[model samples]
Structure formats: C-alpha cells, structure tokens
Target: MRRKARQQTKAENRPRFWGRHAVAAALDNPERRIVRMWLTREAAEFLVPPKDIPVTYAEAADLARLVPGDAPHQGAVAEVERLEDMLLADLLDQAEDGRPLLVLDQVTDPHNVGAILRSAAAFDALGIVTQDRHAPPESGALAKAASGALETVPWVRVVNLARALEEIAEAGFWRIGLTGDADTSLQEALGPKRVALVLGAEGEGMRQNTAAHCDALAKLPISGKMESLNVSNAAAIALYAARAAA
Candidate 1:
C-alpha cells in the first residue's frame, strides 16, 4: 500500500510530456487544462498566454525538475492530456477551396513528420494527410521536432492513401508525387491549382500506386550529388515550391 501510494505521488510530478514542442503544442490545445506552466526567463518571453489559463514563471532548474534526467525541456514545461485524433474525412470536408494538402504515403518516422509539420505550417499549408496504418501516435520526441507545430497543424490520417488521393483529386486537388527519378523537376511541374504533395518512406520512396495515382510525378533538381534528400526535407521544399507557384 505504501509503495503504491508513493508511485501515485511521483506520477503526479512526472510531466505529462517532455521537450518544448510537446509542451508548447499542448499549451495551445483548447482542451488542455494547463494548471500551471513553468518557463525560464528566456522561454517566458516568446509565449503568448490566452486570457483564461494563468501562467507561472520559473527558472530553468524548475523545468529540469519536471522532466527525466537526460530530457531537454528547453526551459518550458506544461501539463496536458493525451492526444486527440482527427478523422481524415472530417479534415477533408473542412479544407478550404484553394488550400494545398500534403499526403504521406507510408512515412512512419514521427520526428520527420513532426519536422515536416513545422515546415508545412510555416508555409501556410492546409493540413497533413497520412495513412492510418503507417504513422506514429503523438509522442515527446515528435513534438520536440515539430517545434510547437504539432498543435497548430491538423494531422488527418486516412484508411487508404490511394483512395484518399482519389478523394482529394475529386475535390479538385492536383495530386503531385515527388520522386528522384521523375522526368520533370518540382519547380517546373507545380501547377497553379490545389495540390496534394505525395511522399513515401525514405529508402523505398512512394508506393507504385501512390506514384501512379498522382496527377504528375516530378523530381527536385539537386546536383545528383547526394542520393536523395530526406523525405521530410523534400516535402518541405516541394511545399515551398508549390507556395511559390501560387
């Protein structure tokens, strides 16, 4: 009974999650009940508090106290609930008429997706589309990589990617697949219309049908020096190129 009681007490102090991105993202969630947020002087400056939730100012050591031994809290800590999942259908329905979408074929790495989310959000992307079967659930490292973009970016996971592409196409999106061996370059092929940038797992690249279903397949004009850019990086550049075309 005593050991169980002690364990429960520690659980309360254990942060809901670690790293700045996770905590910052959690803070932005309307559903998150931020009882008290601790931030170092440096971290405190950048955060804009909503009118409702009260904030706390604490030292860097205070943030360290809340996380694990090796965890880098980046001088901010927020307590929040587990993630909430948004349906792909709902997101598709909500998409605006002209906004571009990004569809991940089967990319499983959370950190990469999270970083891509940051870039997508930076470029004013509509939302992220992923296959439900091959993606990671919300986790600490992913949130960190997202740099608080996890909260801002709506991640829509679908049952079937090919069909999702079909739906997106039916909705008037021009599905563009990014690949290394494609005939045209990304800059040349990006059309002035809604686009769904399809990307795949790192080494294998896009699945055959994923490549086949796209409106067009194009490559980035790298010097062919490196084998390929990371999928997330390629996706980021592709999204940027798409935005530039817009």
Candidate 2:
C-alpha cells in the first residue's frame, strides 16, 4: 500500500495547474497542451472526463506551489502552455461587429485591470484598449484574478492613448468618458451606437487631456457618500449600464 502511494506520488509529481477555472478552461482549449493534472482524492473523483487526462491524487499543500499564495485552487491543477496575445489591429477590425470597445487610459493596477477584463468579457465588448505605458502585463496576480477572462479578452496597448482616442473617433465610435465629478448621468448621455468607453486611473480619474479628447463626458449617478469607487468597480457598473441601455 505504501509502495502504491509512492508510485502515485512519482506519477503526480510533475508540474500541475492549481486553479480550477483556469485549469478547466485550459483543458478545454485545443491550443493548451496540458502535460499533467493533480487533484485531491475527492476532487479527483469529482472531475468529469474520468480524470483520463493523466492525473495524480495530491494533498492541498502540494498544489500550492503551482498557484499564487491567496488563490482558491479547489484541489485541482494542470500544466499548460501560455496563452497568446491578439494584435490591436485585429481587435480594431473586429469592431465592425457592433459591440462597444473599452478603452483604459493609464489604469495601471493589475488586479483592477483583471477585474475590468472580466467585466469586458461579460459585456460582450469588442476588446480592451489600454495605453502601453500604463497597463499591467499578462502575469502577476492580474491574470489569475482575470481567470479565463484574460484569455478571452483582447488587450490592445497603444503608445499614445490620446492619439488612439482620435483613431477611435475616426472609426465612428462615440467616445464616452466616465468620471465621478461630471454633471451628466451616464445613461442619459450615451448614444446607442458603436461606443468606446474611455476610463482612467482611480485617484486622478481621466487626465485633463484624456478627458479633453473625449467626445463627451458622462458621470455615473452615485450618492455623494464617498469620493470615488475603485476604477474596476466603476468600470463594471459603467459596462453594465451600457449593456443594459443597448
């Protein structure tokens, strides 16, 4: 019995994915080359496809090494290839489909960006537009928080956000700037067309010039209880409002 356990250990010792959703989604992707899987005994039996994908039973602590410290891996893990990035032009061209595009200007927090990506995917957005200088990269806790949303959403990073706004305007998108202090309510100001929701950092909100470039400035109708909502929270609310109106 001990030898059998040791043999199972040997088979399971390979690198495994630790996040359930990430691993589950990765397993679904034909592009993902999952090498191995490690699951808790109960979790092992719970997964479908009969764990036929080369799995080993593992203790929870053993799975921690693969995922971040705070992650809820749910006792399942898999090793997979990194996902790919989509070109900005491709994202732009796809805008013809009529879904609104989301533009982020200098919003640097990875967690916030990740949350926003999740929101963007939920809203059926065309893609996420971010400035190359300000946005976070694909890793860190950001991608993990985004979960599978990061893989699904196209992130376009441009050198100049102000200039990019100009390009978006040229593409016939109604650029709506979201701000806390603006006088107008977001829903009343928005047009039902291909829109580009321009957002910015939390503390600073939209930069003066970034705000200036927008075709219109809109504000979320919030009670004057606090100074501001977290950028991602505001973005989620705004995206929901837009989708509801559309």
Candidate 3:
C-alpha cells in the first residue's frame, strides 16, 4: 500500500522521461521545461542539455535508479514539466486541409496513446483529441513508446468528447467512427478532404453516445482470422489509409 501511494505521488509530481530519443526531443523542444537531467558519461558527451538546467553525470546503473523499474533509459533521464494544455478551438483554427484530426474515446493506455502519437506525426496529422478524464497523462513509458513523436505532435484534451465532436463537425471535418460493427469500410467513408477519425477503447469500444456523434461509421478491411488488431496498430493503419486517400 505504501509503495502504491508513493508511485501515485510521483505520477502527480513532475514527469521523468527516460531513453535517449525522449530526452533529446525534450531538450530540443523550446516549449518544454526540463527541471534536471541524469546522463551517463558517454550520453552526456552526445546530448547537449541546456546550461541553465542542472545535469548530473552518473554510471548506467545509477541512471537506472532515476527512472521506473527495468526501463531502458539508454543512459538518459530528465525530470520535466508537462506541456501547456491545448484548446480544441485553437487546434481546429490551425488545422490544414489535408491533415486529419485523430480522436480517442477512453483509450487510456499510455503506450498505445504514445504509439498513436508517433503514427500521427508520420501521417502529418493535424493533432489528436481525447477526453481529459479518460486519457493517460504524459509519462516516461509513454515518451519511450512515442520515440520522440510526443514532442512533435499536438495533443488536445477536452472535458466532453461528444461536445468536442460537435465542434469538430462545425469546423467542417467529416467525423467517422471506427468500429467493427459498421457496415461501411473506411475506404468508402474517405470522401471528405478534412476527416476526423474517432477510435474507441480496446474491448468496450465506443460508447453509444460517442458513436451517435459521428457522421459515418466505418471499419478497417482486415482478415477474418483475427478478431481485432491492437489499438496502436489499428491507429497506424487507419492513419496510413487516411493519408493514402488524400
């Protein structure tokens, strides 16, 4: 119980990012505020942490102590402040014509969210949206999974996902909900130049209300043998299809 309490308290405090890519990206992003960094001697030689931030040189074993258990820190770890909250309105205003918006409904796994962010960056997506309450917060595991895409992609969290869908429709995006039960395939639903792809949680799928908000319901064309793809893999495939259609 005490260990659980300690972990929770640490999560509530400044996030510590590990791995070389994650730390390098954090150092490169002008908006990111790195509180402190711990790097092995070899890693310190390559990563030029800002002079303003305190950096400590340590052995690989000592660096391991700074992050979560068995995390592949790759000789780098940094405590950082979370990025500022982004407004859904601002994201919509700044969106480009060919870039699609990705929305999440209760997809709470940090690693999945991070991989989705990586795919979003690869596809030149406008940004990603999620309900503030249901999504995972920024963390070391997430950053490592993202492999630096976390720094490049914009993530917007809102209070009401359904209401946010309404606003997205108002912004002229054709909101398409991805579900296995949908009669239409995703390819057929790709007519609109501006698209908003909404994906639900892994097993529970999208809530009824959330599905009702979409302009169309569609599913990926996959093999019959597999019941479902991992959410992150599905997201990458969906993003690729969206890009190909454009």
TM-scores for every candidate against the unseen true structure: 0.79, 0.79, 0.95
Rank order (by TM-score, best first):
3, 2, 1
List ranges where model 1 is wrong by over 4 Å: 1-15, 20-22, 33-69
Q: What digit string (tens of lDDT, one per residue) describes model 3 on residues 1-246?
A: 999999778656888999999999999999899989999999988899878999999999998888888999999999998999999999999877779999999999999999999999999999999999999999999999999999989999999999999999999999999999999999999988899999999888889999999999999989999888888898899888888898
Best by lDDT: 3
Candidate of highest TM-score: 3
In the range 1-246, model 2's lDDT, one tens digit per residue, is 999998677555433345666566566666656666778886766665334577777898887766778667888877544555555666777775347789887888888998998898898888888887788765535655677776677788888888888888887888999987788889987765788898988688899899999888998887789777898998888888877777
Between candidates 2 and 3, the one scoring higher on lDDT is 3
When 2 and 3 are scored with TM-score, the better candidate is: 3
lDDT of 2: 0.77
TM-score of 1: 0.79
Ranking by lDDT: 3, 1, 2
